[model samples]
Target chain A: DAGVTQSPTHLIKTRGQQVTLRCSPKSGHDTVSWYQQALGQGPQFIFQYYEEEERQRGNFPDRFSGHQFPNYSSELNVNALLLGDSALYLCASSFGLAGVVYTDTQYFGPGTRLTVL
Target chain B: AQRVTQPEKLLSVFKGAPVELKCNYSYSGSPELFWYVQYSRQRLQLLLRHISRESIKGFTADLNKGETSFHLKKPFAQEEDSAMYYCALSPSGTYKYIFGTGTRLKVLA
Candidate 1:
């Protein structure tokens, strides 16, 4: 099923510019979650989407937002990016609704490496 | 606040030696813990979860609620086992996961 897939394996952007990263969930999965992993750090939860709405959000700033389409594909949008935004953006997919039995086990993609110059 | 911590930034062990990756968490309610592994040039994948009580690639972790630690261990490490390992926690009734900074395991030949 190719599992979870993300677009643009790597990206380069300047400060104050905007960028959008895309993700397609695994087959039959209905939820998508976004995470940011800085170099030498683990992945930090950004937000989660289910049923086309944001079900949960992390402590990230308002500049980081996301959307989920009907097919469960998701997009992570960052506005006015800062140099600190340079990191590996990861997209994870899981089955069932949030807090469900199987939702906590997520499958991750290759991740999009975003570099803010 | 919910958080996960992996104290060691890097761990080196000889092939066939025992290995342990330490992880501690801070959370109020029942926590679902998971160990994730990322091999070189590969995506991050789930190694094991506390609920399932199963081992993957001969690695197992026991969630000690008393000490609030879920440490991953393997009796005989192999060269293929070298990778970055992360400990994660999902608070009760939530899907968001708090991950540790991760430990890089290097199994020398």
Candidate 2:
């Protein structure tokens, strides 16, 4: 398996513009999660999707949203981007079981480098 | 609020020297802790998880619930071990993870 794959290795946008990043989960994986990593900082969880529904969310604002398709692929959408939003957007996939913490081992992709001007 | 902290931004050690990357967390309840590593030009990957109690690439971490720390350590560091290390915390029954700012380990020759 290719593990996890993300599209558009890099992106550039201006303030108030929107952006969408895509991710394909590892083979047989059913859960996908999104994270944002600012330069020199660790990744921060944005949210997670399972069964095509958002299962959990982090402390991010409403402008950051996501979707999971039936094929287990996922997309992260950032609306009205700001300079602060420029960062590496990461997508992780895992086999999820409700209320099961051990199955939450996530495999991450190369991540998309988003630069907002 | 759940949070993970890796106090040191960078750590340098000579090859074959001992290495330790400090990680601390703040949370209530039983949490699952993990260490993640990112090599240059590579994706971030899991190094080890507390629940598994296993070591990866000569690194091991013991979760100290009392002190709320999960420090990664290796007796003999190698040049290949140099990378960015991150400590993460996942609350029980939650999919979200809280990650530390990360420590950049540089093993000099």
Candidate 3:
């Protein structure tokens, strides 16, 4: 079975430009979350989408936004990208509504490498 | 606010040596701790969770409430065990996870 999939394995953008990264969650999954991992650091949660609505968000600024489509696929958009925006954009998916299982594991994708110049 | 911390950015040990990766967390309420690992060229994946209290791939982690730590340990490290390990936390009844900076493990032959 296919796991979470992300589009445009890599992306390039410049300051003041906007970029959108796509993700297709694993089959039978309903929740999708986006994370940003800078070099030599762990991923920091960007936000989470469930039921076509954003459920929770991290400490990111308004420039970072996301949408969850009816098919459970999602997209992360970064506006006015800065050089620090260059990092690995990771997408993870889990199976449930407000999934609270202690064993709940988020399956991740290969991630899209975003480079901001 | 919930946060996770991995003090060591890099750790190297000889093959067959014991391995211990430190992780500490800060949360007021009950928290779910997890260890996630990413091997070379592989996507990040879950190694184990504190709730399971199960050993995976000969690795285990115990959540110490008093110390607010969930450290990953292995009795004997193998070359394949070398990877980037992250400690993540989710507050009780929440789905969002806060990950630590991560510890890169290298097992020398």
Candidate 4:
């Protein structure tokens, strides 16, 4: 089955520029979460979206926001990006509580690498 | 504050050697723990979860609530096992996962 999919695979933007990354939830999954992975570190939770509404968010600033669509696709937007924002953006999907999610397992897509100049 | 910690940044071992990657977590409530791995050019994937109590790819982890640690162990390392491993925790009453600083494993031939 086609797993979670994210695009574009790589992006480059200058400081203060805004960027949006997209992700398609795995087939039959509803919840989508975003994470930021810096060089040599594990992925850090950014936020999670369920039923088109943001359900939980991490310690990131207001500049980091996300949206989920009826189709279960998600978009991560970063405003006023800083050079430190350069990192791999990973998107994960999971079946909601009503579905048979395999206990807390999150399927991740090949992340999109964002490079801020 | 709840958190996960992996003390090792990198670990290298020869093939057929026993391997262990340590993970420790701090949480007020009972937590669910997991190990995820990412190979070169591959997407991150689940290796094993403490709740399963099942070994995956010859690897197993036991959750020690008393010690507050979950260490991944494999009897014999394989070159294919080389990858980045992360320890994650799910706080009680929430789905948000707290990940530790990952430990990269290099199974040398």
Q: Score the docking of each candidate (DockQ).
A: 0.77, 0.80, 0.67, 0.61
In order, what fnat does every candidate score? 0.83, 0.85, 0.70, 0.60
Model 3 chain A poorest 10 in a row by lDDT: A96-105
Please write out the lDDT profile of model 3 over residues A1-117, one tens digit for every residue. 689999989988889899999999999888899999999888999998888988888889999999999999999999999999999999999876454433257999999999988
Across B73-101, the per-residue lDDT of candidate 1 in tens digits comes to 99999999999999999888777899999
Off by over 4 Å in 2: A99-103
Model 4 segments more than 4 A misplaced:
A98-103
Report residue B14 deviation for candidate 4 (angstroms): 1.4
- Candidate 3 matches the true fold with a TM-score of 0.96
Clashing pairs in 1: none
Choose the strongest candidate by TM-score: 2
How do the residues B1-109 of candidate 4 rate in per-residue lDDT, one tens digit apiece? 8899999999999999999999999997888899999999888999999888999999999999899999999999999999999999988667688999999999999
Question: Each candidate's TM vs. the true structure?
Answer: 0.96, 0.97, 0.96, 0.96
lDDT of 3 by residue, B18-91 (tens): 99999999999999899999999999999999988999999999999999999999999999999999999988
Error of 1 at B41 (Å): 0.7
Reference-based TM-score, model 1:
0.96
Root-mean-square deviation of each candidate, in angstroms? Answer: 1.3, 1.0, 1.5, 1.7
True contacts kept of 3: 0.70
lDDT of 4 by residue, A32-100 (tens): 999999998889999988889888789899999999999999999999999999999999999887433
Lowest summed lDDT across 10 adjacent residues in model 4 chain A is found at: A96-105
lDDT of 1 at A76: 99
In terms of lDDT, the best-performing candidate is 2
